[model samples]
Target chain A: MSSREIDRIDGSALPLRGDNIDTDRIIPARFLKAITFEGLGDHVFEDDRAAMADHPFSNPAYRQARIILTNANFVSGSSREHAPQALNRWGIHACVGESFSEIFRGNSLAIGLPCVTMSAADMGPLMDLVERAPDTSLTLSLSDRTVTVDGQRISIAVDAAVRDAFLAGTWDATGLLLDDFEVVRGVASRVPYIRGF
Target chain B: MGKTLLKKVWDLHTVRPLSTGQTQLFIGLHLIHEVTTPQAFDMLRARGIGVAFPERTFGTTDHIIPTLDQTRPFQDTLAEAMLSALERNCAEYNIPLWNLDSENQGIVHVIGPELGLTQPGMTIACGDSHTSTHGALGAVAFGIGTSQVRDVLASQSLAFEPLKVRRIAVNGTLGNGVFAKDVILEIIHRLGVQGGVGHAYEYGGTAVDAMSIEERLTMCNMSIAGGARVGYVNPDQTTFDYLRGRRFAPQGDAFDRAVSWWRSIASDADADYDDVVEIAAAEIEPRVTWGINPGQSVGVSERIPATGDAGTNGAVAEALDFMGLVGGAPIMGTRIDVAFVGSCTNSRLSDLREAARIAKGRRVASHVKALVVPGSRAVLAAAEREGLDQVFREAGFEWRGAGCSRCLAMNPDRLEGNQLCASSSNRNFKGRQGSPTGRTLLMSPAMVAAAALAGEVVDVRDAL
Candidate 1:
């Protein structure tokens, strides 16, 4: 494992207080027909934002923000990989929520993005800060497994394996499978081979 | 101490439990589709591996196949490549493939049971998650990843941990207009999306046992979103009868032996369970999704729940904001602009008949665009036989060919930006119908017909 702490993404956090913002809402299912994940950032919430012009993320000031903090159930719906790929194309580096759908977590992890789950209380102040000050640089540290919005430390529990995978930048699912195979083989080697001559 | 469907299937398939905390389980049938197989085949080619048991596996195209027009050299280059790749892989492996022109062509989940390929006592695997839909026939069907797909193709076995099984028993009788779609929507709503997270649900009791094979398939299909590995109903006369004459199923004496084994694999009447859930059949109504997820649901008679009324479940608040729905408005009067009736969830001939029965002699509301998609060619032929297509066409519903149209919007069937849809398909996650801002309200096939006629959310009972 790598010893260095992976650098956290810096951004003016875009806080969406919505519930059940699903994979399609994150990126519409129409975009999934495309061959690759390139250029999907252009269509992010294309219809939702088209109706609601004043939404925070639609504003030009939030263009460079790489971190997004939303309420729980941020990613729910069909297990479409295009959802997170759209977010990544939109330049999203990390997402923090109270909870996530199991399929969403698996897809996000496969592509090297971290979905951080924080306490609802921890998210409230940060949401307020983002809405109150658009220019505020909120630092989200996945390595520390905490959310610091406008310099306020918010404790959020994270799975050690998820943290280590992101921190070491060793988020290779295929590599993980290889390691698993070796370990399984090692255990088998120590056991009796009933039929193999 | 529990004997769930998972245990029953597991014991029947196990050769031995390996030292690596996984069981060496035999797979009796393997189903594949175009979308997830191209990459898996490439991986196999790189390693010089071939499918171990060619006769036990089958392939078809669904995900990227067009329902509207499937001309040569598709407008979608990637889709064309995917189809080409899958065709090549199937040919290279000498596996029987039912391509687009075949009379049997349709969604993998739909075709498996139609041809009697899915049967009781069979351990089935597909690369797509909705593979569980075939479990309606009492088979143990689960989705696996691409690597696992390669694993199955190479070895005809999968190594995996055992899953707990939950027995969802529904008793009593269902009210008219409350179809199978309502039964599944109610199950997901009452259980919440995560309720079945680590379990395979074995649906039984008077309700499941009483249902037609098609209705049972709809119930098993949605178990994926409920977080279950798979779901099934036990095999019986209905199952054996369905498989008895299919092209792929065993014939005559062999079939007799197969039926005997299939019957024995069913959970014993005295079988214990990890958990038992009781749902009254009369308690369910024509349901719909009020917010972004299937969990964010309400009956057609109820209104959307407010985030403030969510009472500290953080997910509810998030769902509400994403949905932009006001909690207090009655769902009954909510206007709908589109109505889609297709997908592996509710696209069978029986589903169309239920919808058409309600839609008979009634036109869709002027502003509402209604569509009726058959699950497969066989369903289309069967519907045509019963004049169900005429009923749909007279009702102002677009009668389309077979495919997984608008379920995930990989094809042309999609909701224009923010168009709310009364859908009979399985899911209702935000933007699931092709429009990122589109809202989906899931319900029974009958309810979708009623909603389409009224051009808004309406009680199916009123239409009935």
Candidate 2:
């Protein structure tokens, strides 16, 4: 475990159009049986890509897209860490949506796949821009809390502490917990239920 | 204004406020199962970190364990590997594992409460989404991802942003055949899956107060379905009574002290809530999901909603297409190929009893493969003691051992291609029960039994 930072992402976009695109759709339940998250990227949107030939992830223009643009409530089911791992492995650096599920956002941030949100009023146009021009590159600034696409700057909303962690390269929570080992042991010792083997 | 049970428990467990505006909260109980913990354990080994509190954690093999056979060296190599991994990890980490042979072994959510480990005012964490099921004991239990599983294993703490409390008050009398499953399905129907995303739903009111501990557990178990991170009912005499005489619960005067503390942690009558939504119990029906998501549900007698009538026209179209159903047609009498009466959601003794009552003297349709998996080994023992297993067996339903069989399907029990199932489990997402194209319809255990008997989705009220 080591400290990691995600300050900005400048890449093409893959626009997934829908509200409540669940984790099941991101990475289906069948793929969750693996011992580790390795090799999950190739199967991201496994069902949708196979079911629908024109799914955005499979669209040739967005082949190397590093950002996922979508509507409200993206990644909204089951707390499968594979959802983010799939995206990270598939080369997704950031996600811009109207909102994200709590567990999904946490999972994304933990793996350094920043999930940022823009107001709904601003999201529609931004999504249209990305979809209308797949070649359009977008830049997301964690410190500035904004996304710049085609010279247009759109304000994004992110939890301040979350953004701070991303900007300062201090978001590796596991590493932080490991660093505060003595304090963690102190807290564990205080818990009535905690006991050593 | 008074504090909510969520706040009371949360504040009590806060180790310190982190620079990230997240509270480093101590977790009292950590639950693990075969599927999710293997990677977390691997992470621990790779990092050379020991579990901070082994006793605070408990392990069980549910997801990958075979419910039909008890022999070692499972037929599925992957399943065997998962079980072996869990066994090795638990042994090396010094955590007590409730293996298949253990009396305490069952679904992670089910065993915790039965063993009296799920007490009031405690913060519980598990890798499975149904961890919210433990919230029925008045604890703030929510699911975490595998990475957080590693974090908790190493530190026994989580960096969490506190949630605003949302009071969902269901007042008035519930009509006949309307179980706790209906109440939660109705709530999800009204709120949509994303409605409770950033909040902790504190269920209260006359309807919830009248429920048994099992019923309350059923309600809180689906909190994840409503997109709430955590859901709980306040501790009352009902909760205390359930805990008394249990394995891990306090005994004698210590029990009395524990009860007092638990009572003190209940949300005050005037507790401040960020939002309050009221549901009239009389309005709720024996609900069943007709679409892929939990929110896309209708009353037992209601028609499959038209695309426009379903509110989200595009989503309804997609769901209807995926489910192979027509909009504006009656959902009742829709043919089902399978019926599953188990999951962390509704597989307790009471659930089995209800299903058995419906299954008595009736046989499962020849085309419908039905199964009844108990939530815990204790539940299985209790059901066997009452001859419920025999009743199910006689009715042509395969009575399986205790495990999460056919619910998310990590074991041999899974749906064949395009098989439609009536499931008592929480999620109805496409392929949630194993087969990529398999369809699942969410309903009560009794409803699932009814479907098995009738060969199609039918109203349990009429069957009764």
Candidate 3:
């Protein structure tokens, strides 16, 4: 089994100021019609970018941002992995938010994108740092459990299991799951419903 | 303390503990659809991996199928390409698929239960977030991303972290015209959208227990909207009766045995829950979302909350700006141009019947464009058998074929620019209904029907 360890991401951050930023707003359903996820990044937040004159994705200063900073319940609607796939393809390596929906976090982790949590109070300065200095570099270190920007450290929280998965390069769960084919069959056999009782 | 149903089911599905502090949980059933599976199949092929248990997986075309014309070669070539890819992948992997022409075809969640494939105590995974709909049948169901879909296809299992169980007990009886949709909306409104994170909502108590199987499905269907990836009610006689003779359900003596096992999986009366929330069912009213998320809802008679509402945290302001609604105004009479009553959330026969009842003797307002789409072909056939379709057509509401028509708007049924629609489907997110500028007001199917006739938001109870 081969997987890439994603313990740290260092780059400029894009700040999307909103709570409950849903997947529909991230990558609209119309864009999901394609058979492949290719070119989805071009359409990420397509509507939002068009509608909001100051939307971060449309801002030229944040064009090459590799990290995203956002508010609570980020990516709340739809479990389409395409939302994260679009962000990943858009060069987002990590997201720091007040909170994230369960499915969105899982989807991001599966693709080796670390979604970390920070307090709203902590996020305020980080978001300001990114917005005030668009070119400022932010470093998210899973090993240290902190995001460092302009020599200031902000404590962040990642689910322990998720942190371990990223650190161990087991974030690609298919190989980990496929390694236990025999045990899976054994469990399936024991379930009465699977065996027609 | 006794174990909750989630605990029992999670233990039953556990294969082994992984070093990443997760359990390799076996999936009893895996559902796929065209939108999310193509990439997963690609991943499997790239890895030289074959489907581990093809029989346990099921595929369908819903998101991209054009509802109006069920013809070969869809008008949208991109949609056609997606459907073709799903067909080719399913055939290559030996996975059973319910294609557009198949009687079994519909939304993946709808068909899974209608065919009796979703059962009690099973762990169900699907690419669509509405997979929680199967939890109505007492299954431990949750939506997954494509990578996890690939994981299940490769090993019939996933590395899962167990969820804490929260028992949301809705006691008392529902008031007149207060449907399951209202009950869940009230729950989401009471609890913030992110309240159920890291937990599985165990819906129960008098109100939830008294709900029919279809009603329970509607309630569970929006669990994801409330931030719970998994939600379920313990299987009861109601569940067994609903599944009794359906296609994939156990038969004869086996069914009797299965019921016993199903009953055993119910959360114990003295079950230990991470938390408990009690709601008075009578307090729920027909709900209407006035904002961009499901949780931004108000009772039919209530006014929209102003930005000054203490807990809104500027969301109220953002929603008002986006929806073009004034704060403190009554949500009762907001004008609407469209009405859609179909989705995995509320496109069943019962939902159709409810909407048809409101449309039976009334004409849709001249300015309103309305349509009814069934959850499944089976639902459509049953509605036709009951002449519910005729009632809708006579009322000037178009009766269309099954597929997830307007909800998410992957198909041709979509909102035009800047039109406000009263929708029965879940999620009122910006751009959710095809048009970026179009606005959606989430409500029950009956409410959507009432809105259609009134050309504005109105209480369904008035018609009832």
Model-by-model lDDT, in order?
Answer: 0.76, 0.88, 0.92
| Candidate 1 C-alpha error for residue A71, in Å | 6.2
- Using DockQ, rank the candidates from best to worst: 3, 2, 1
**Between which residue pairs do clashes occur in model 3?**
none
Question: lDDT tens string, model 3, B1-464?
Answer: 99999999999999999999999898999999999989999999999999999999999888987878978888899999999999999999999999987999998888999999999999999998989999999999989989989999999998888799999999999988899999999999888789888899999999999999999999999998899999999999999999999999999999999999999999999999999999999888999999999999999999999999877668899899999999999999999999999999999999999999999988999999998999899999999999999999999999998899899899899899999999999999998999999999999999999999999999899999
The sequence of per-residue lDDT tens digits that candidate 1 reaches over residues B1-464 is: 43555677787666555443446666778898776566668767777767767877899877777777889788878778778887888899999898888989888888999998887767898877777788888888877655567667776666655677799999988888777777877888788776775578889889888898999999999887676658899988888887888877777787887777677778887788888999999988778888666666787778777656745366666566756666778888888899988889888888898899899998999999999888988998999999999999998999887888888777778778778888888777766777766778888888888899999888989776
Give DockQ per model, in order: 0.15, 0.51, 0.91
lDDT of 3 at B231: 90
Model 2 scores a C-alpha lDDT of: 0.88
Residue B6, candidate 1: Cα error in Å is 0.4
- Give model 3's share of reference contacts: 0.95
lDDT of 2 by residue, A92-139 (tens): 999999999899998888778889998888988877887789999889
Number of the top lDDT candidate: 3
Quick one: how many clashes does candidate 1 have? 6
Error of 2 at B287 (Å): 0.4
lDDT per residue as tens, model 1, A132-195? 8877886778766676765677777665665766676645333333333434334333321111
